[model samples]
Target: MSAFPAQPLYLVANGPLAGRVSVPGDKSISHRAIMFASLAVGESRIEGLLEGEDVLATVAAMRAMGADVARGGDGVWRVHGVGVGGLLQPQTALDMGNSGTSTRLLMGLVASHAITATFVGDASLSKRPMARVTDPLARVGASFTTAPGGRLPLTMHGACPAIPLEYVLPVASAQVKSAVLLAGLNTPGITRVIEPIPTRDHSERMLRGFGADLTVEESARGRVISIRGEAELKPQHIIVPGDPSSAAFWMVAASIVPGSDIVIANVLMNPTRTGLLTALRMMGASIDEIDRRDVGGEDVADLHVRHASLSGIEIPADLAPSMIDEYPVLFVAAAFASGRTVARGAHELRVKESDRIAAMAAALGACGVACTEHEDGLAIEGTDGDPIPGGATIATHLDHRIAMSMAVVGLHARAPVVIDDAAPIATSYPGFVAQAVLLGAEAR
Candidate 1:
């Protein structure tokens, strides 16, 4: 199926960016809010929800299962749920457009419910690995008939009163962990997940807020999370904070671009998602925090970033689970630093919406930045704060982060940077072009 328009966008070197911007609500939390609210007994109200394509796919799927989900004129989303184990068998397939989270987590939610649902996705999502999720759900009595290699366009028949067991994660993935937890909500007995390394805890936090009987404890090995099944979730009023991942673009853009001073508002500063900030500070970025406070159940802050002469540093591998989504743009920041930057233990990038390691390496090579791609990471030699040669059109293989990362590349390049298609950005940040223009990015 066609993914994006075959159009190109050019970004010329802009002047200093000076402004404050509030990015959209956290995409991860937005998806969970819709899912959890749709499972609660009473009506749940949500504010600051991300209206991006990915989250809307979750809403559409939930609505297909008989939940009354709608946005009122007052700008609040209200969902009257069908309760746990009350999900109806969809009359048609769930078209999860370009969203791995919606597909995987919904599969878990649909598992153990005695319903048959078919799942399908766009070309890019279809190519992602699904065995990581399907294998675990299979152990819980959910049978799947998938495409080759356990990919999407598959049908799942969930078992009522499914069996529960403990699972150890071979890789660090919040998506997989969340899927199992969502599945556990409808099964009998206790389901346990032993994470090798902790990923984003948004699912755990949101699930707890919705009254799921879940507990997370740190053991010597890793985190052991146990959830009591057949949960009776109560409705909640949720106020989602801004996405730290989306604010990453501005963080990198302001750090390297000359004479730039920008502030990102209402950013989620949860410890699990602040790896990009920590890595940037290690590279000597001039970032300051103001008006820090707690909102809903997460930490929120306003970040004031100023242009700084950054030097490359070794990114800590332990921080990979926290900053996985921000690595592509972090690679862009590494391209402008003064020394060699080494990012290792991030093989997860290989399986993202695109092969981010390969994508960034190729894009940087086209812009005259020296980079070497490894099996797990990237090595980049920066230009010592000088403008890079960038008179090339980089191909974005339907990855939203790739397109946005290259947009930051144009800010410090000697020549304009052209992208093959920026339409994919609508998946996460719909107002990116306008935000970039407001922050002084020359685009046409």
Candidate 2:
């Protein structure tokens, strides 16, 4: 999706990694911060906002829709909102780049307004299904014209005084849930979503932070989440914590590399997003939580990780929703464990930037790690903490997680690991290479 030329990278066995570092801001929260700020009544200041390409797409879309968004030289981003039901029709189609989150959530926002806008994306994002979000929005009186198979490159027409509906999630997806809730922000009455399985609560937390009328109730069926329509939003100063997804690479890298000890600062400790930590600790990783505190509305802590001999464990299927994005790196971690690691209940990985399970299997196998690809997940055979044969160049499939995951493998491998293209890392973690190098990874 990036216009930059393919950038290949090589990583070899590095010495003991030791450093104290912080990753970029939470990508999920960063997207919401801009969206909510743009809908509030006054100026909202944001600190530690992620400036990655994906988040920038959200900013660009908001600006095109009449939100005054600007970044101060002092590193704080300020947004002047246009108020509820006040979005201006954009002059051009919204280019979402490779960010599915931006496209899906923005579609929800536009679905309840009186605006008609077209949404387009790069090749990778265009292949993803948009029907999941559009189906729920259509019940709210919005109409959509999408590519065959409900893919991207679509046009949506919003409904004024949109119909309020109660819908149940067929799957556990934060994106779909957020889209429906966002549409409810401007509808005429209460819109309700019954989530059979809980997903990330960033949208609900952020909506409440912006003073929207929202509530969650536990019932016999599931968690019933409701948002009142035509609500007024008030702006507030927000400080985003470091992304745990980004920190996962460091967590896995330090655990396997011999004698490696590093401290990752200000990582988000949201319960719904810490499955990787739980899985790694179950594998005998020495990760300690130090100085736990609250930042904005989420839990933040520094992770003190040290080298430990890891053993493969049967990862719980219920944990899939919490660490779905981190599975690629988790596979790399599993490769160094003492036995076989089995993962299932992650069919969602098939729809990410690439088929992560298949992509990781091929990449790891190319590096001489034994792996079996499954319809829904993967099973990897570990080298018992020994160096794996890694003299092969891996195809990244334009997936950032796969690129970074193999980079971790190279650190403990017998030979250098070559990435065909690392450019996709800029979508979320632009400083990934430099940050790894700072932690003693030999990269070029």
Candidate 3:
């Protein structure tokens, strides 16, 4: 594993960017596809799977838990499941690398089984809060011995004859919700979760695809999801669509720099994950959806984007859950828009691999963009297509989103921007540099 040097990017003003590129598979779906396949009764095949470190961590953890998962020729992956309630203890600790998704989801999967497993990660992931999952899972009779403040490098003790209960999510988190549902798979009766705000619903959709009895209903407070316990999950093939989060970088780039036309193909159009697109549209970005189709229970479409003048608007806090992963790039887009863009209700951004809100604010400020930071969000004043003086070096803090977001800003900056570490980009989106270069972005 080689470390990526402190690469700086240079983008000259006024170049037409035109190309069609397909980003890697959806990170969320890729993680769930491997996990569900590993728990099914038969062999499961996956296509368009992300080979990023996050998804690979799930694959490795599944293999450690007694599943036969392997890569074949033609870029396909196969996983032989151990059936429900058949996970065997691993001989070593499960190293999740930099993936919070892998660490949190696997904790739920192993919580109700008859095994004890320790989870570890890189420095950034170890700092993220895990109490969201551990606190709720503990109510269902699972026990954990974690670091102070419920951080990682923790051990999960499974609850045999697991207790199934209805849990209400205090915050809008898909990981915490999914963790409970995964644990419910081995428990008896029904396990329910009430979400105040709708997060990404990949787990619910995928679990239903694997033949689990899962149901969603709207309530006065919010949405309620119920999963029946002790049910057999049928194995099925999954085709992962390109990640919209990864596509966000190109989308923002194509929107701001003049005379740029780029098409992103076969990207996931899940409503729960399209907040970035919606926010961009609200800013009058020249983006269109083309050749819509359905693939493996997900909506897929090609995004045709062209450069256009953008005007900023206030983004509602409720929309945060859908595009939480994309705020970094969204902030970059706001820096060049016409007015002040205010984003609220984003407390979740604080606990990601890095504090995304703070990171974006700091980076944007360093680059001569005026931004007002909030406890939960930020207010950014756009320059309305004027040249932004950039001459600042950004510390990515080993966060992939931070690195990519800064690169997007360089496309319109007065001077080139430098990021401390570009190495972390491989954790979720490999070939990021090549994809950006194909779209007329210069990276050195």
Model 2 reaches what TM-score against the true structure?
0.98
Which of candidates 2 and 3 reaches a greater lDDT? 2
TM-score attained by model 3 = 0.98
User: What C-alpha lDDT values do all the predictions have?
Assistant: 0.91, 0.93, 0.90
Error of 3 at 357 (Å): 1.2
**What range of 10 consecutive residues in model 3 has the weakest lDDT sum?**
1-10
Give residue 270's error in model 2 in angstroms. 0.9
**Candidate 2: which stretches are off by over 4 Å?**
none
lDDT of 1 by residue, 86-107 (tens): 9999999999988999999999
Best model number under lDDT: 2
Q: List, residue by residue over 1-444, the lDDT tens digit for candidate 2.
A: 557688999775458899998999999999999999999989999999999989999999999999999999999999999999999999999999889999999999999999999999888888888888999999999999999989889999999989887999998899999999999999988999999888888999999999999999999878999999999999989999999999999999999999999999999999989999999999999999999999888999999999999999899988988998999999999999999999878999999988898999999999999999998788999999999999999998888889999988899988889999988889999999999889987787
Every model's TM-score? 0.98, 0.98, 0.98
Please give the distance, in angstroms, between residue 219's alpha carbon in candidate 2 and its true position after superposition: 1.6
What tens digits encode model 3's per-residue C-alpha lDDT throughout 144-252? 9998889989998999879997998998999999999999999999999999888999999999999999999999978999999998989899999999999999999
Off by over 4 Å in 3: 1-14
Of candidate 2, the 10-residue stretch with the lowest lDDT total is 5-14
lDDT of 1 at 306: 99
